[model samples]
Target: MFLLLVQAISLLLVPPLQSYHLDNAFGNPESVWNSLYYVVLLLLFTGAMLIIVRYKVNWLIQAIMAVAVLSTLVYVLFGLAVLLVPSVDPLIAGGVSVVLSLLLTALLIVYPEWYIIDTVGVLVAAGASALFGISLAILPTIVLLVILAVYDYISVYKTKHMLKLAEGFMDLKMPIMFVMPRRWGYSFMENNKGLPAEGAEREAYFMGLGDAVMPTMLAVSANAFLSAPPLLGFVNVPALGCILGTLVSYVVLMYIVVELKKPQAGLPFLCTGAIAGFLLGCLAAGVRPF
Candidate 1:
């Protein structure tokens, strides 16, 4: 439960990063490269998980996790500093960044229970989403979402190799996933090989980090790119619409995954809801489709 909360919190780092990137600069090439960068990050995560699983190098795994967690905090700080600093100093900020990153890394190394893992997962998810959101415009976000949805379906249903990645993470007990235990006594530590079986229907629930990241890219893109009247704080109509839409879709999908007793690709549902809501909001505002 504590770990889940950590993961959820980690997911929040994206909005500010998106806002920062958009406010600072804009270009198609940048967005293209940003998308490529995410691909690399995904591959890196997969590789790390594979290595951890193969070697049973718990220390190495902890180090990687610490780095991920600290990197998220750095992104958060970078976004916050953007609002405060007179002039951006990626260099001077670099020093402070290293210190903070090291401290978080140390903590993860010292103690890595479910709570620590979940907290770090949430931060990493948020940071990744924000960066991607800011980097991608609406069109690119849409393209990315569509492509990934197809890829996810193919990988899960056709190739079946994606399960290998999931298996790797499950074996490592990495906090890079969200866990829902069916029974009260279900223990993550007990089953290091993979998710433990609980009953006839299902033993536990886990959603990969990508599930959160992929949808959020669209949410942030909607907020940053689509023009909308403010609804609350600085958030606008399209952004709010996307947020609500994603949440609604998430609820529906969770129900399906739980009740139907089947695995589901998250982005298809989440992105659909977000895009649909954004379009609806735009229509309500009398904005024409581009």
Candidate 2:
């Protein structure tokens, strides 16, 4: 439920971000090569993160992630501030965004509570999805999703390095992952000591922020690039289908998680569902599925 809500909210932010021309934080909008650049950058960052974890340079990784989180928050917040008050000065809005982002980052670094991490994680995920969604067109976004889904599968199942990454991230308690407590009394700080015992009852659930961000990249792109009439006032038929499909897959993913009590590669199911839903939506809307 929480993850779905975050995805929906991220989708909602797309049009506004597009209106403000705030998407594509990292690439040239006119070039078809942007997708390739993005993929390469992603791989490089992943390698860097793995090296950071391998070397136990927790503070450096956390600092790098904090800067990323702050920048995205400011991007989204500045756009939102301008949208709410069109006459507001960009400088003032930007200053406010910086301050807010700084405070949020401070909270994450100083306190590092589960709820705080989750809240900030959602905002960062939303901002990133919106940015990337508008940056890439349909075909490129599709390519990105397919590549990421494959990479996620390999990282999790074949190499199993993703598991190591997860363990390392748990130690930092950064907003890179969302935390869902299964029990009333759960302490993220305490749980960070180590991975859970194999057969022990888990006290909380953890899902990568990427799982929410990736499918949402498609939803935001659909909303931005497709001209289909709105199916429900806010989203077009195709985008809505993508969102619904993701939710359906999420339900299935959760079922497997709860039933089997094991870690799963979320992007495989999520990306597949999103792509299938997108194609179905395109068909219903009489748009090309490419």
Best candidate per lDDT, number? 2
lDDT of each residue in 1-290, candidate 1, tens digit only? 33223223323444445444533333562355555555566667666777666777766765676666777678755655554563777666657766765665565455544545555556666666766675677776766777777767777668755666677656656556766666787666764456333233666677777777777766666656666676644556666666667778888888988776766777777778777877776776665535
Model 1 lDDT on a 0 to 1 scale:
0.62
Give candidate 2's whole-model lDDT.
Answer: 0.82
Query: Candidates' lDDT values, in order?
Result: 0.62, 0.82
List the candidates' TM-scores in order: 0.75, 0.93
The TM-score obtained by model 1 is 0.75
> Candidate 2: worst 10 consecutive residues by lDDT?
24-33
Q: Please write out the lDDT profile of model 2 over residues 1-290, one tens digit for every residue.
A: 66676666666677567766777565665465776787799889888989999999988988898889889899877766776787888789889989999999899888888888888888888888888888878888888888889999999889988888888878777748888898877879777654565555678888998999889888888888889879666688898889988889888998988887778899999999999898899999998855
RMSD of 2: 1.9
Off by over 4 Å in 2: 26-32
Candidate 1: residue 103 lDDT (0-100): 68
**Which residues of candidate 1, in runs, are more than 4 Å off?**
1-66, 80-100, 182-187, 191-193, 196-203
CA displacement after TM-score superposition, residue 110 of candidate 1 (Å): 4.5
